[model samples]
Target: MQKDKRYDQLLDRIENDRDELVELCLKLGNTPSYHAKERNVGDLVVEWFKASGIAASLQFITDESVNAVATVPGSGDGTSLILNAHMDTGPEPGPDATEADKKIDTAWTEGELIFGRGVINDKAQLCAFMIAARAIKRAGIRLRGDLTITAVAFETGAPSIDKDQGVNYPGEGFGTKWVVDRGVTADYALVGETSGFGIVRAECGAVWLKVRVKGREVYTPRLERGSSIQENPNAFAKAAHAILALEEWAVQYQKKEKLEFEGGAIVPKAQIMNVRGNDEISQASPFCDIYMDIRLVPGRKPEAVKKDVERVVRGLGFDYEISAFQYSRGHIAQNAGPLIAAIEEAHRYVFETEPPLPPSAEVSMWRDLNVFNEVGIPSICYGPPRQRDPYSGAGNRAMKISDLVAATKVYALTALLVCGVSDR
Candidate 1:
């Protein structure tokens, strides 16, 4: 049979297992592991890996639950070819007012949209890659390169609190000391993050910050002589003044530094993202916290950014507490890696059109691309653009089986292009 035919077969297999896949994603969504309790989903991934004839185990890399090396190795170089995705969902899984009132109700469709909470955020990608692994095994694939993969916990939780202050933050859930001892780096990584347009060559690294604004509190009705206007305003208005100051400073920071992005452009003239005041944890209290998201292009120092932002706060006459703390950075492989060429050529043969600009466009959104990048390995983002309309051909909600079929063909053909036309 032709290689393209086999690729179609793999995608079909995924379709065959669609119900199981959806069930798995739903289970993960319902786990309540969000960040603090992650053992449930981590164990589930291990079972799936073991079933695939891969040796798998779970461990605590950071304080959060994570996977040990899950591998399928034949006679080949140890440089693993990784298919990456995460196991964590966004916030706690519950219906908010916006989601409760959508008209289409695709999620209500049996075997259709399946929306509860994490239907789109990331569980879809995780399920896709897991199903892709099964399809590969079922399609009888043996590679010249090893394959290693992981879906870690706590990838979504954030906003650390000292805890000593008895101040717990939302989302991150009281700051667990999660550490990642990346066992081994892979030669190439496919993030499995809906890489439809082709390959995402570069990702902008991000740093989150907590910016605080402080003011004295006084009783209401003491309008003229009391500590604050807006009847104490939660004493938050003056803090708003400091917030404006930070924004102005960020604008100025744009003037001095810039990163040279791919496609003959510069990335992130200053920091890419900022979360301060009500934008951060503990909004109503006297202190306003903000998160600054810094998208770094490979070489910028995240520490320097911390100092600069702190300086900005001081210049604005705001007494601020700054901590560089934790961050999930960005990464890029050579504009074109070995498998990348094969992947591109495969898409060209199948699609019969030149791919869009950079092949895969990795967004500023965080993913395992940063994990491999931190460990000195080559990785890029690849897959379909399923996030665009939210409702594509298949169910008019998530990726159709047809979308998976197209992606599977691209994956197999890319394999053939790199491994050669041999029945391995």
Candidate 2:
């Protein structure tokens, strides 16, 4: 009964602080922390943490990028927990961005929902972590173990490709890896991402490959026709054949690499992101580059996957070179039972139902969970769902305010359970 009373106090405190949590979410969602440029948002997070009396600091990964780390120290008797979320939003709008695209950075409220780019994808959960700690502090709950909240930069899956300039775009767990390597660890980690309030134990890793196909360069007006696409002298013609082959291979690959776990299934997928070639109109290109993004299930080796890709592309009878510019292996938590039990209990206390598994699509994508599990810290991804438009079948870059409050309660309760309360 005393434990139940403590849970009530924490939930009440979180409910009373809903307005402040919403304000923080809006503030964070309004800030444009585009990938690789998250300094401003990071500073805001630091200020909020300090004002709330939590000890906080920034781990600078680059001159313009930093990971915000905040903590509520415990008395060193129970296990520690890390609640992590990315500070950076999705990619910025390009030159031809629509008005809707431009509106992604601006936060707005309608009825019970908050609309913005980062609001649902991450900013909401980031704010929830901060508010959960504050609620614990306000409820006079002295934890026996530490509760650390991290807002890392560069959790976006974009690779660090150096083209015209230097390596300007550094992503794919860059900040999370840095903080982990620098000793910001815990007994377990809960990554706050868009998981539809379900628990995700496994996630697929990814590899970005650049497949270059070589051909003879010739003037467009003087180019000779060939009997088949493979015999054509132009790289673009041969690339068509390769693309078809890849399309066929991708269907089979997804079926062969599907992985199933207790939580859900991970269907590894592949796609040709872009095809690059010469832009000069008067000449046939000498070479074409196909950039591919391939997702791999846990225990799958990247080198083996690359070899499989090479075999498929080489069979097109074209001279080619394939190289993986970026790769990270997928992982499953080896000892996540304790953490899962804590979350499940907290979730049931908050929602009065059993927690469900996230959709297969959510588990198939990459997130910072992979980073924590890679360093031997058992981790899982959990957060609220994104509101979907019924008619348009499009996901709104928004989050429900009620969902935010519920997630905050669950996070605080989970922390209380995982990091046992102290008498002091």
Candidate 3:
């Protein structure tokens, strides 16, 4: 593919500011922004935007959460683009978490990689978008269409369930939905997420279901133990049986509902997230509630999955009730040709090869890209790889510096290509 002279210029500018990019990423990553608490990181993001001469502001979401919206205005005749990344990191460590768990949120550099909890999941991409826009401004490139960079809060998969404190926790896509509903839209959107330098146009939507199993409450002395868990009077025992049955069903569900698309594949999965029963050990609980998260491909209704789950658990011969508390349908980008072409060109220029397909895990997981596609703005996710820890065989809380620079270059060129240049 023939490269544009302007594209070369943009890449050169990004390369020149590599140190600044790393510094910004480290600062953002080192700050804690666990869901519902993004004010500190939001402040840092806004500060960087203003320092780099980009128009930026914070859209307050809650008392402690805020979304940072920065923009480069265009001359009004070309397609606009929105570059998005979440402000929240993964769930915070529990009170009894190990030292390693506690250190996951603190960013650090080791050789070529930057490590932190949200670095690979989002902050790396967030900093990349910021640096990319800064490079565009420094290079004095005026776009014909607007370019918006958004770092939204509460994009993690945590849901709000009312307990003693009420629904204080706002769920995923909360800030993105708020910003978009209030006129932060564009003709196209590119979500910055971890995709191993691949492009993704589809993601799995999620359904949060609560399943309750009822049983006769009894004190331990008067409790009647049965040979089978189904016959046991304790709801906890029956709940255990239901959990096992659902685990078996989940294996088959993933196989049956796997969706293969041109951009990538979506594997709908099911997992039991939480289970609640009696607080007292001496008394048998009257009911046990199971919280489950079931992922679905585009066009799969929550009602249908509810029925499927009912069929499996009902077979265990127990009285149970199931309810879907939240449902968000997965989406594939429509009218995304121009955005896709721009990404392909930019990726080729940055990596010197055709962009690869996103990992199945990244493609199958939900992101703010689904929110944009849900709202009729054609959108896709493209970013660098998440490094894995060789010793632990778990996802390393880190990202490669080289990968971050490459993603930054792609983002800048993609914005320029999609938004076009003003002949000023």
TM-score to native of every candidate shown: 0.72, 0.95, 0.96
Instruction: Evaluate all candidate structures by whole-model CA lDDT and list the values in order.
Output: 0.55, 0.87, 0.87
| Candidate 1: regions farther than 4 A off | 1-33, 52-54, 60-64, 77-79, 93-117, 164-182, 217-235, 248-260, 263-287, 307-312, 358-361, 388-401, 412-424
Give the Å error, residue 193, model 3.
0.2
Per-residue CA lDDT of candidate 3, range 136-211, in tens?
9888999999999999998884776636233235566877888898899999999999888888999989898999
* Span of 10 residues, lowest total lDDT, candidate 2: 388-397
Flag regions of model 2 displaced more than 4 Å.
1-3, 162-167, 279-282, 389-396
Among residues 3 or more apart in sequence or in different chains, the pairs in candidate 2 whose N, CA or C atoms overlap within 3 Å are none
RMSD of each: 6.1, 1.9, 1.6
Residues 1-424, model 1: lDDT tens digits:
2346666666567668766776676666555455445567778778877887777777664445454346655347333466666655543533652443232222322333344334444555666666666666666866666666556555566545444122122232111122234344456666666645556666666666666656444345543433533334443565566567667766766555444455223345344244334333433445555656655555667888888878777765545576654565565556346867766776776577755644222453455666665566666666655532343223223544445445545654554344443344
Model 2, position 379: C-alpha lDDT score: 97
lDDT of 3 at 106: 73
Q: How far off is residue 345 in model 3, in Å?
A: 0.6
Best by TM-score: 3
